[model samples]
Target: MSIPGQIAAALSLWIDSVANTVSARLERARGAQQIAISEDEEGALTLRLVSKASKDADLPPVRIGIVDGAISTPLSPEWSAAMKGAIVDLALRPSRFVFRPLELPGRAVEFLDGIIRAQIDRLTPWSPAEAVFHWTPPQPIADDHVELTVVATARAAVTSLSQALLDLGATAVDISTATPGMERIAVHHQRIGGQTGSSRLRFALIAVLAIAGVPAILSIGLGGIVTDSYDAEQQQIQRRIAERRAIARGSQGGPGGSAIELLARRKQTMPSAVMVLEELSGILPDHTYATELRIEGDKLQITGLTHDAPSLIEILERSPHFASAGFFAPTTRAANESGERFHIETRIKPQFGSGT
Candidate 1:
């Protein structure tokens, strides 16, 4: 490989190694407190420390002691005195520091009390373990002894743990509940707290948009009313247009008003047809039988039977009232009567009858 390529490969490997180490440590810490509860292997869950105390064969792997009330342990007494404020709460013993890892059982509480008494006996020769271990509530003792609560257990254990931690050169000891600490450091701290704010803002923006949508829907409903108004206006305009067109058509021309004009024209022409029929009746020779009369436009056709066709023709020709009358169907033998049947058409001119 080239020099640059080899260097890149080395750097990648180094980065991978660091990432794996950090991930493994995080997983170990997450399981730490729960390990002791489920198993007797205390060291697996123990917080690793930087030891300054010389190793001694007789010392137990872990020990316990207690303190009085709350106390402050300084990283540097000079700076602590200079600042003159509480940096953190901690407990101390000879070469050990203590911390409250989690809540302890009642047996653990008695154990802590016994350990503190032992510590007091060892450190101050004049005080007996029982005398140093004695604790009384501020109020008068209701009974000879008051029950030791978890509060006492936590205080005693945490103080002793802090002192034990001091032997290992650990300047600070932290106590945490297993569940809350896991949630706080492991779960919550792994996520971005600021993203939670962004999510909330997004939720609020969606709510605003949803609320704004109502006005748009209302506007659409209002538009429907406006549209209906527009449609009604259009219908009215159309009705007026149709009415005006009808009026103009009625006044304009041929056939003054539809069927009325036709009826009037028929009335004028029908009187003449009646007079022609009357005149025909008078002019027809005897024994001439008329059976059918039909009118086509201005022409009238008469069809009937006649005994003498020549006489009928003579009667028609002699009439000055008739313009021209001619037989269309000449006489032919009928079934009941062997008589002549004929059809005659005539034009009724104005002079055909009494100036009609």
Candidate 2:
């Protein structure tokens, strides 16, 4: 692929990842209830609330009848309301899926998903795109080998069922199957409506493009006006500088008495707080947060919480604005806190643009 095409693909994948992460976080925050719907051999679905504290426990399981690729009886008002914004786990009968036992070296566990996807056509009648499949977690066996059960079904068979649940107001649906004595294995999962990852990616891309286009349009329209204003100001400053330099040369018999010389000398001696803060912000990772920042003369001290405290020293030392970065206080983590509290001290480079 061309560079632009590769960049576009990367941006799409990143958006999808961010969307999925945000959706997961929102789901957790909302405390969405989980409902389990299990299919029987007779094609009836029994819905049960998975939560132990659920008030709906007193209510009996709702039996759903499916016929001719559609729901035979629509959900009642109460059940439909209960299903809204709820995560539904649909467990189909094992008979509906084709189960194949797969054995491999224990080292292949990390790459199980890719390996299974490559072998899907050989293991089942359906191609990878036409099937929804998942495998059980690898179980250790003798001779450094691991075993797993691959569960799969035709995509067409589950599509209608999942759509029916979505129509009943399920926010998300997960399809799975299990044998009598085996653990349940997931087959497919999807968010309902236009809330899927791909949908979110498209929305994010449009929003980003709209944001970026506004700046470009503004720059194009006001480019000449801004440039002309800057040029006029720059010429005025140059003329004044020349007059001051000529006066200094005539009065003092040499240079080093001009305003620009004084300003440059002061800048070289003093540390800029703005530049220090900006440099630190750019150097720190997202997971790190500073609670205290102190600048006394050329020495800088920072107290913060970070996921990895030891790495901060190396990060600060490598920056051009800081030198001799080291921990002044021992790093510690409270039992309830997720990150380590760190205290670090470093010397700030006082000379402006010296690192360049």
Candidate 3:
């Protein structure tokens, strides 16, 4: 197999192992009843509820005979009902399984399962795939070595027994064997309800992920297209602006230059009102008072009452900010007025720097 395929298989096996462990813990926490089924030399089966409580010990065992892979006597209704949602521990006669002892360095203990599987064919009459097998806990021996016994039986026999118990409504089945003087060794286990539920849940999760992925992929593609479209539009607008600016620069000597250049030239030649007001405030006499002032383009107008109206024109004409200073209207005084009323207009110089 390819590396990716091998990795995927490994990951799947790990997930299955973790899920089974969690399920087993949850079942134990719920205190599921244990049922023990033992097979005799004649292939007859004995079933009894294994419980710690004293009251359960008085219940009689149910016996059933097996012939040609089928039960000859069916279980009673009460016994059948008790089988549902129970953990069935089935102990087969030792003669049905082959026992082999294996010794390995103590460091190899963690990898014992893989080592036994690889060497199963050399130790037994059947291949690993054709046999259901398990090893007892390792015992430390001399020379830093550990020894254990591998108990194995034909897969067909164990499968037949487990299927029968499942058919009788057992939630899970554990297959084991005990030698004349050795402790019981568990060979295989099956969780009927858990397997079916896990398969359904895995299918549902895959379906949900597939459904959600379609919209996510489409949204990413559509977002890229929209961004490209906006970028193209922006580029086109920038190119048009550049073309317009080039045409304006080329038409500078025509009827009128660009509007921006025209506005800039006007600003340079215009007289600022603030500068004009500042110059006038210093130029005017202390006795003179101005009531109204106006500045338009390069021209300034001042109207006020003063003790000396003629002297105002002389003062303005001498300043660098005023080019031509004169009165646009006649100077007149009213009967109740204490001073002469004068109107003066001036053509301001474009020398904004000297004023500053």
Pick by TM-score: 1 or 2, better one:
2
lDDT of 3 by residue, 1-356 (tens): 67567545554654555566566556656777789999999899999998523445466798999776567889987787678888888998999999887766565686666567667887889998999998889899775657788889899888888888888898888888995556998888878867765565556555675689679979989999999899679757855665565466648656565665445444445667888889889889998999999888667899998876778889999998897889765564333466667789998876566221
Task: Pull out the clashing pairs in model 3.
Answer: none
TM value for model 1: 0.23
lDDT of each: 0.41, 0.76, 0.76
What digit string (tens of lDDT, one per residue) describes model 2 on residues 195-251?
A: 764566669776987799789968977997898799679757855774565566556
Clashes of 3: 0
Candidate 2 lDDT: 0.76
Model 2, C-alpha of 192: deviation from truth (Å): 2.2
Report the lDDT tens digits of candidate 1 across residue range 255-350. 656555444334434436677778889988777888998767556687887766556766776777555677654334333454556678775543
Tell me the number of clashing residue pairs for each predicted model: 13, 0, 0
Q: Pick the candidate with the highest TM-score.
A: 3
Worst 10 residues of 1 by lDDT: 184-193
Error of 2 at 18 (Å): 9.4
- Candidate 3 deviant stretches above 4 angstroms: 1-18, 51-59, 196-356
Clashes of 1: 13
- Report the Cα lDDT for residue 288, model 2: 99
Q: Using TM-score as the measure, what is the rank order of every candidate, best first?
A: 3, 2, 1
